[model samples]
Target: MTLTAILPTLRASLPEPVDPALWPAHTETTTDDVLVAAVSMVRLAELTGTPCVHTAEQAPPRYRPRSWMPRDVSVAVASVLRVRRPRTGVVLLELDAVLPPFAVLDQVRLIGRVSTAAPTRTSVVTPYDGTDGEPFHRLPAPLPADVREGDLLCFPCVSAIRHRDVVEPVRAEVSR
Candidate 1:
């Protein structure tokens, strides 16, 4: 399988131009159908650097044919969860894909954060509202020890454990 074959498959999954807000309520007939729909929709959203909505201004650039890892899929993962803004953080991991006929669109990129060894553990640090007086609030439980800097942590709508990645320099592009 090549990356070229996957590009069209991803695009084919896009929801027609409409309001993205309705996505959550939209239903697919089967689990397999839903998975393909979800992956394509989410990946498109990430490519455009836009929040996933029923209708988006522009379609994401096509993905170029290449072997994509779980990391490559992280940007889309975060884009999918941008609304939730996981205060706890996420870890994106790439799963296995057999060589198959895939379509090539554009290269996938990852948005990640830079961390210093001092911080050591991956934890969510919430800024405190002045109204409450506290300067900052830290969430309990740090991300897994294995999670390192530059790793893509995607939080999809479904299972939290379903993470993937690409082998590249993952740059952190935290949304405002």
Candidate 2:
């Protein structure tokens, strides 16, 4: 979990935000609470309430220096919907999105595109305003057998997906 060079233009940047080897090898973090095996996820969500989920029938598989799929706390609390560039040339189609703990966006020497492939259709390089022509996104409804028209397509500004990954958005504010 450390090939990150941080930001390199492609945008969707969220390079660092809690990377404890991607949690759950029996997660434990008590100054407040976050236990797993010892169980205390906010006291099991105040005794089985707020969407509680704590599990572990086995533990010992931290592997993911480049990813072979091991470190998994149910895919680390799971949450997906990442495509945010708030400011840039703009790009975010969801592109039939799917990058769950598998592997496929290629290039990962300094960590950039981390999509796990669904049949490949991700390319990036925007800028077409023949001064202003308008045409950037549109596709869906049983349409992915491959379409073409000079092709040159691209879409991805995933501000956060962390395949090694997410459930990361809780900037601090919790007491129990």
Candidate 3:
């Protein structure tokens, strides 16, 4: 271990401390690692290897259909997924939303109807399948995206978060 690991003050004084709110509850940063649910992420990486996904054990929040989305955005990504092709068990999502910012083109998830399990996007849309009407290129989606009968689709603010991280000198919108 390094000297910084030995001293708590050095760890506490991070030049670029990660925002805890960006992650799950009970997430904290040590000098050398981020801990979720009291498990050390760095330690896990040392044992298991890097690019490791650490799932913190926590009670799932009871989310309404539009619970996680922003007030300005409206979801039109379809409530339930339908099998577009029988053999492959494929589902297609035609993106059409009331708001421009809400019409997410990629990196989307189909939240489980019965459970909170969500699957990430699988493939890019082919030209024959897409629509000329809207900017969205229809996606031939994740085979097992935990899609259920009443599972509503959600657009996580991943892009906004990414923009915040990647872009510099950002202006926070303020209203009087």
Candidate 4:
């Protein structure tokens, strides 16, 4: 389906506005990258119903139908776990933890660092944290040789989740 047709469904599925504390800090970057990341965020939001925010500048010129966009457009862009590009290696890792919705980004950070490549460049596909008692979704069939599964991982909870330093190890069900 066209993006316009898909947008409404995406917006409707998203959870409540993402907590500001969990929002990624926007740094000065090229418009093209921002646009790509914005679109990626939108797709991710559509899948998980996790709220994401992107700046006006990041909005793609071609995606003109703004009415159906997800909420909190004014907040900083959500952190990109990885960007898929030719010749760039991409890894998908499942986050296994009952993370608060806001901690998703932090979990992304942690998985990025521990993976074979840098988190900034690697794609991390986190599992639905068990908060909703959702059954773990399996990684795509015919997984890559580089992809690892059933690996335990951990990272510090975002400050919003706890005032003190709480080192938590979230099990990463899959890694690529």
Worst 10 residues of 2 by lDDT: 149-158
**Where in model 3 is the C-alpha error above 4 Å?**
1-78, 81-83, 93-102, 112-131, 134-136, 139-146, 157-176
Better of 1 and 2 by lDDT: 2
Quote each prediction's TM-score: 0.24, 0.18, 0.28, 0.23
Poorly placed runs, candidate 2 (over 4 Å): 6-22, 26-54, 57-79, 89-176
- The TM-score between candidate 1 and the true structure equals 0.24
Global CA lDDT computed for model 3: 0.35
lDDT of candidate 1 over 1-176, digit per residue (tens): 22222332332333212222222233221211222244444344446433222221222334634653222121122221212223434432221111111201121212233221121123332233246643322322232333433243322221111122222224588998
lDDT of 2 at 126: 22
lDDT of 4 by residue, 62-155 (tens): 4457564432222212233232343545444443333344333332211111223222233444444466654432222211223344332222
Full-model lDDT for every candidate: 0.27, 0.30, 0.35, 0.31
> Looking at model 3, which ten-residue stretch has the lowest summed lDDT?
158-167
RMSD of each: 18.5, 17.6, 18.9, 15.1
The most accurate candidate by TM-score is 3
lDDT tens digits by residue: candidate 3, 87-111 = 3444444222222342343423332
Clashing pairs for model 3 are 113-151
Give the clash count for model 3: 1
Model 2 earns a TM-score of 0.18
- Is 2 or 3 the stronger prediction by lDDT? 3
